[model samples]
Target: MTGKRATQLALLGVVILLVAGLVTGAIGAAITGRDPLLPTPGIHLAPQLITGEARGETTKEVFSTDFVLTNTILSSLITSVLLVGLFWLGTSRLKVVPGRLQSMLELIVEGLLGFMESVIGAARSRSLLPLIATIFLFVLFNAWLGLIPIYQSFGITRWTDLSLTELSKAHVTDVKGKPTITVEDLKHVVEAREAAAISASGKSEAAVEKEAHKFAETNRIEITDAGTIGKQLVVDGNPVTVEGQRYAGKAAEKIQEAGGKVKTAQAGLSAAFLRPAGTDFNMPLALAIISFFFIEILGLRALGLGYLSKFNFIGSLLRFKLIDAFVRFLELVSELVRLLSFTFRLFGNMAAGEILVLLSAFLVPFVITDIVYGLELFVGLIQAVVFAGLTIVFAAVAVAGHEEEGHTAAPEHKQPEHGGGHS
Candidate 1:
């Protein structure tokens, strides 16, 4: 590597690290004595997960937004743009002895092409290289995209959450048999939640009481309406609103007035991204449609009438008319099964992989999460390769099938003419 090239590589690596840190908010976190969080259940180290009072599920939005720009997107885009800029500069310079970065990129492309050739042969690989590369890029981008922690770190729009458990419900009930809006009622409700949690978990009464007291001591809450907008109330010069007569603090009121940032939560259904690899119906169904079309096209192009041999279009097997028809139909089902199998296989694998990484991160801190993370990255890449590679192999078989058995068909037809001539 020339001095310039070496410098460029070092710079590029630093840029990546910097951008990754920004996206994950790791640099700032390290400075602030915080940790990177994996999106998971049971615990949320950062406010990103959006939680409410304890005691089970939180359906309330931690944050909500309508297509608001997030830090994650910004960081990922910056990283990608910088990487591209560097590549362009290096490639355009066109060094007879390429810079280290250029040389490295070349190696990656060559290695990938070589791998594809091994899987589908040089001729077919050449034809399918573009698709394979597209798949590779998609996988790479999607895997890296989530590393940006901007949106995770801070969000603008949040949801109104209310804890309405049976126990809390009781604590708030007034002397007149109505849930009153009072500090005493709120305190009692908080305590009730603790009791309920321990009881539901089948814990000792003493433990539940201790925990209930602990939670009450720690939480400073001012309950508001369950609606999207909080109703305003002036309680002692401080703005307050009651949800079920529970107060909303002046702090929440002030932020709401000044237009505090809105948080954009995930708006899409999880299923779309989480669909397993080939295990889901989509991948294989796609494969089946794509594979079968080419198969038929090749079958027709090469075998012509002989392609019907797949259905006993020739020979004495047709003598058992019923059996022949049944066999042909059965073979047709194989095409459909291939598609079904491909979809679920990929969906199951990818979904499982993504979920595992999430859960593992929740189990431990990020520092020791390298092994599980590496495994996830590996699985995602392999799945991408397999899906694309199989597509190529199917295409090849479809194109080549007719050519291989093409001669057999003409001979069979000739035998029929010869018999007719004898008769």
Candidate 2:
């Protein structure tokens, strides 16, 4: 096919797919009684095949398995393995006339080395290439991997419990010996109940919250004695009962059936099996720590114990130069701040992008999601380059500290000599 014709055909196919997806999603929503635009992306701290117990119960101890494999860790490991395999295969045999893989590797290495050389010079760039390149490739792979739809879809089922106190404050009735939840408290109660149910059923918390809001807006909550409350209370014009003190809901029922204390369950729910690796704060923090450590090591190797002087304001303090000391103190603060900067920048960008993609997919399904996927690809590449580039710049600054100090001292030495010569 001609290139222009091929492009037109691709666009046609995408339009058809989007139309089909929209129709299918709308039909599914109608059948399921759920909103087609509501996203069910699970957000979790850790990935686990099974959840242990609901939090907030002082009476019982909840313990999960010794180790649960999380998606972040899984993604990191996979990225590392792929990087190793690619480099190994590319460099395995010496090539007089390089093959495609070898040429690609050479191009990437040469490009990075040339860039680093411009900042830190050719000698130091070669030494720093392994660390810089590994970080770039690993982060790049992770960013791209997250764009894959499978990461958002598949995961294990887990349950969370809710406490009554968490839902709302209780008014203790002296005669019936039952706590009555007020109308104001009912919204919170229902939301907690709904969230638990939805999460346990492997739906997203976003969807749960949306449903809870809709239910709360439509319904009014009332509590009275079992005799006066009737068979059910009217909620959003529908009758819902309290079987005892608990709300008549699937979440409450599940808790009761699971032999869990339902005096109001705690908020625990099922989530996606894995969160994107870059979204986890620890991943970026770990990378920052590693980068900083290596930067320090490179500084130490280049300038020995003299590198400590870059941070120490002791000389300024002893000399009674308050301004110098203040500047030095600021420098110290900036050094520490770099860790936070590195950690948050990567985490925030990646996490926000992942969330954006999820929201877009939920709102528009096939069409808009594809556009977001492309944006994420660009964002991922930019982030990887930024991270690696910053590390190189920092390394350059760290190692050049002595040289900077010498340059500063030279002018001082020259000034005295020029004054002496004039005298």
Candidate 3:
């Protein structure tokens, strides 16, 4: 008892010191206006390209067709391999008395089956188990595996002079001497561009002039709406183009490290090769498309030609019942909108969770971020459950006509026992 009590007290002391240190360190940094231990993370809406000549480039928009492959694509492939390997290992060598992996697999399958049976029916649940179960596992694995340290830490590097919008268009390689731009130089260009925009917006000339002066000590430069000042812009007679937004961050870091010039800086970037698949809009959108088709197909299978009546207003039109036709049209619109709803819902949640964990780590590195990671893990499971649960509910609604909503109670049914013969 004495030794255990001593150990407890020691652990308590360590925790106390940790909290105190974090608080004091944060306070000191705030008061002194110092940079946080970790640099502010850049939030990207689009996944970084990992293949093709444009690899390492990222776009501002979530939807882009220019890239061949991205980090998120690789992450999805990894998730697929993991899911296949895991189930294969669990089922390949089953015994009468199951091993740990087999037991875990059974537990997961049984729980999912029970959940589905509650929503739809025992027979229907068993029939649709493969689709719903695969989605849940895929999403869950993608989220959980992303938390591994290497997913965020290891990746290709980005250089300062490279084209931000499309790496294939970068002119540095074609130019002689690789004429380098400084961080200060980029800052002036950005500020000039902003001042021009503000001036064009009919701001007071004096205010625009003052802003321009603060941005640059030389003659005020004007940037066109197309992001170019003029064709005359050149370094050593080679034309140079700059993306102010990209230069505002990682490029700035490189220039600062290179003593204001990217020519001498070692590469420093944080574009991980394996980001979570959920962070990419494409992944969630693909899943939603699959779910949509499955739901419609299941409805058709159950109701036959009658299922078409849900969206078809032609009968009402023939009867001249305008109100009924309009209402059915609304329902049709709502049904189609579910595709976008599913896509954005999952994408937003996963992206937000990723950002939360990243910002927490940047603001307060170790202990606090670990706590956030735990919360994110719970959130991940919740998202997977929500996604899978909603899919089952929708499937039930599709197959059960309009009466499913009015039915308060799911009918009692016997859960099929997993017999030893299967194992």
Candidate 4:
């Protein structure tokens, strides 16, 4: 009785000390103006620059790829690698009496396999195990990485600052070591040219100067109205008149030919090449489309062409009647259903997950987003697995007709080591 009492007292003392330590830490954090409980803000993942055209080069807008691919895809890739590496490391050294690591893996895998076997039965489960395992691992890795603080935000950058309108304007690129005609600078050249022509043609000096000034005030360069300033000034060398804007263009070319200069502004070598994360819809769509296609492929490989029949209704008819003729009749619908199902399934889940995370973050500080962060990770993995698994299941069931492989009787379930069999 005494020993029990003492043990309880000791445990109580330790708990009190732990509480005291926590309180002290909290107090210190408050005093330091640091909210230790808050999640750190992730790096921004938006394109900074839409680089405009340069002189001499074609006026092209370069899509800025500052933080998009680097932060999102790179992290996903890393997570995938780690998952593959860990599973590889653990499984490669398998033994009859598993080590602690292997045992832990076996527990997870065994659970998954058991679940799959029950759903798919022995024959199909064995055949689909490898693909299912790969999907499960890839998904889990993507999900787990999404939960990591570093993955969400780190090592960010901006390439340039350019407005949509300004970015659309053409910048000069063909610098010939001489000043060239720019749209704005055309006014000055027109003013000088019109004044000179008027003076040379014997107009009164005051009238000529007044007309030139009038043109300059409005155009700030040349009198380009009708054929006054914009007209061609030379045929080989003797001056004549033609029509249009760009008086300075002719002069600038002449000046360049007669000893003038130009230059090019190059982007810094450190400029980033990947688009910012979430800035565009292409990445997510690509992810959805690719995963969906793969899923169908998985189903096709597992089940056969017969597997793809009844995603809608055509397959049901073809099953009863072997009319390869009717195949095209319902193909559009079948393909659309399969394609849309895969696309929407992924798009809807990802979009929802994204919006939910954003709302949560907006309501609470980033520091408070740990729960959602983990949720996103789970959602990503589940979506990936569900997508791939469904593909395989549909294909397997479709092609094989749910009964009678070569053998007279079904074999004992050879449950997969992953829960990717059907559901």
Candidate 5:
């Protein structure tokens, strides 16, 4: 076949798939009284547990986990390894005629270094290149690598259940001397009812008790294989059989109650084994803190003790210049405020991007999601640049000497002259 013919055939296939996806996706499923081709993906703000025992069943239990290993951590590790491996490959062998890998690496570094020199001097930019470049690469790769299909396609299934024995122990008598369960206690009440149902259905006392004990325990969560994730779902420990594309949630529950093993939810619900580190608040906050530390360090190096004077309200207050003292205080607050601004800016954008992609896939499937993915690639690059570029800019401002408006401009700091530089 000719290349042009092959291209035309590929396009035709794509168009057909797009049409079929729309017909079977969320909208079409709703109209047809059938399960959607894709289940509604759940949104989670906090990073999901990969290997840890939470205090409770929900994400709120995250705070109390014993040595939690979250999906975001896995993602960061993978990103780090990828970066290290690529750099190693590029520099491990020297070539007068550069290979593609080396050339690509050089292009990125040289472009980033030139940009930095425009903000700070060439010497200073070169000196800080390691920190700034690493930051940019880490953020960029973490965002981009997450776009891979495997990141959230497979992970620990989300499981929740009621515990009757725990509920009974949690009850208390109210002022009216009547037994009443709080709304919070309702989750546990279902276990007792389920146990009785099993007993009525010809299960022996011991068997019923054992089944009851299982319900009284916290929901069992296990990792689903990537190969079977979207196709076969296990709820409460039982593999759910789909009739056509639909699985009934109530029917699954009934099966569990009647002593047939099943898991929670209609379609198997799962948390990803790896999520974009940028989507987690901690990842961005950590980067911001590291950036803040380096900025202050650079300021101190360039200005010595004079740098501390920016926040030195005591001298102004002792001189009874309350206004100047207030301004100094504001400056200090602004410095701290940068941490929050940096954290939320990256976190919000990445999280929102992730949600948009998932929703696009769920609602329209094949065609629209590809477009959204392309947009995300651009967004990821922009966010990485903004984050690293801001770090360099802030460092520059920090090191630049300050002069009072009415006073003679202070002589430029000699520190930057040493190696930091305007040349």
Candidate 6:
């Protein structure tokens, strides 16, 4: 087949797949009696250690773990390993004429080095290349990794429950002479149900009784509301299900066995096993800290003790020039502010981009999601470049001493005596 025809055929295949996905998702939602668009995609603010638990238990402790492991940390480690492996593979064998992988690596390094030279000059760029290049590549790779289906769709299960106070605060009314709990109150009920399950599992009486006491503290309410609270659970980064049927927990099972269905409860919060590293505050904050320390160290190494003058407003204050001292203090403050700016810029953009993609995919799966993925790719690269470029600029500025800008020795000039020049 001609190249053009071949390309057209490939495009046709992709279109067919996307259409199939959309149809599948739509049909699934219809059969389930749930609006695919109504549910917000799961995105957790904090990482969860355990995968599953009963939601809404009054017992404060849900799962047992000695240490915390966040999705961000996992992604960072993965990114680091991938980056090292990639560079090693690409450069392991030096070639007179580069292969595709080696050529691509060289092109990227050379382009970035050239850009750094323009900003900070050649000498410093070489010294700073390792830090700058690593930051750029790491951020870019992590952001792109998030766009992959596996990263978004693979995660651990987490169960979250509301506090007793929250349940007590819920509105209640009477239904058929029985105190009826509304849909809102059902979330609080899950806590009791979970405790009961633990008790039924033949745990210590003290353990079960402790949970019972906590449950007792929760004020009871009538089920005046027609609908039951829906329990949200995630397994494997997608909604929990088995054989085309949603997974039912103990509470759900009991209700279903009694010929009833749940219709109005919140899902348990589940943290994905791998989140984009850049989306986490910890990643950017750590990067910012490293950049700030490096910038300071570069200044000190380049200018020695004189580097202190960058923040030394006390000298101006002693000279009785309050305005100059205040201005210098503001400059010092700006240095600290740079840390905040760097952290927020990276974290905010990455996190927001991820959220936007999630929303778009939910609202219009398949086509718009692909488009958003493309946009994220561009955004990720741009963010990485911006971060690396700023680091280089800051390093350059820091190392350019105050004396270099304001004071320099003049070159010696030769002068001849007016009367002796001829002799």
Tell me each candidate's RMSD, in Å, in order.
Answer: 14.4, 11.3, 13.4, 18.9, 9.6, 13.1
Tens-place lDDT per residue, model 6, 1-423, is 699999999899888867755654544566667645334355554443322322553222224543545567778889999999989999999799999999999999999999899988898889789999999999899998888877855643334433323332332223332324444345434455645555656799898778756654544322212111234422122234331122224444544344344443334324446788888888999999999999999989988988877477899889996555665687799999999999999999998898888766765577767889899999999999989889988988888765553442111111122222454
What's the TM for model 2?
A: 0.65
Clash totals in order: 30, 10, 0, 34, 5, 15
Q: Tell me the deviation in Å of residue 368 in model 2.
A: 1.8
Candidate 3: clashing pairs of residues: none
Comparing 2 with 5 on lDDT, the higher-scoring candidate is: 5
What lDDT score is found at residue 173 in candidate 3?
23
Worst ten in a row by lDDT for model 3: 223-232
- TM-scores of all models? 0.46, 0.65, 0.68, 0.46, 0.71, 0.66
Q: For residues 39-126, could you state the per-residue lDDT of candidate 2 as single tens digits?
A: 2343443332322333432221123543544557767777778789999999999598999999999999998889889999988888
Best by TM-score: 5
Worst 10 residues of 5 by lDDT: 222-231
Better of 2 and 4 by lDDT: 2
On lDDT, the leading prediction is 5
Task: Encode model 1's per-residue lDDT on 241-298: one tens digit a residue.
Answer: 1221222223233322333321211121111111122222343445446545655665
Model 3 stretches with alpha carbons more than 4 Å out: 1-28, 53-67, 158-270, 401-423
Which 10 successive residues of model 6 have the least lDDT summed? 409-418
lDDT (0-100) at residue 79 of candidate 2? 74
Give the whole-model CA lDDT for all candidates, comma-separated: 0.47, 0.64, 0.66, 0.48, 0.71, 0.66
lDDT of 5 by residue, 185-293 (tens): 4334335544655665688999988987785563432223221122222325544334311333443343344333332333444456788999999999999999999
Q: What's model 4's lDDT at 28? A: 41
Q: Write the per-residue lDDT of candidate 4 for residues 232-284, one digit (tens) a residue.
A: 22211223322121232445454345333322111111222332222223444
Evaluate residue 381 in candidate 1 and report its C-alpha lDDT on the 0 to 100 scale: 72
Residue lDDT tens for model 3, 77-145: 999999999999999998989999999999999999999999999989999999999999999999998
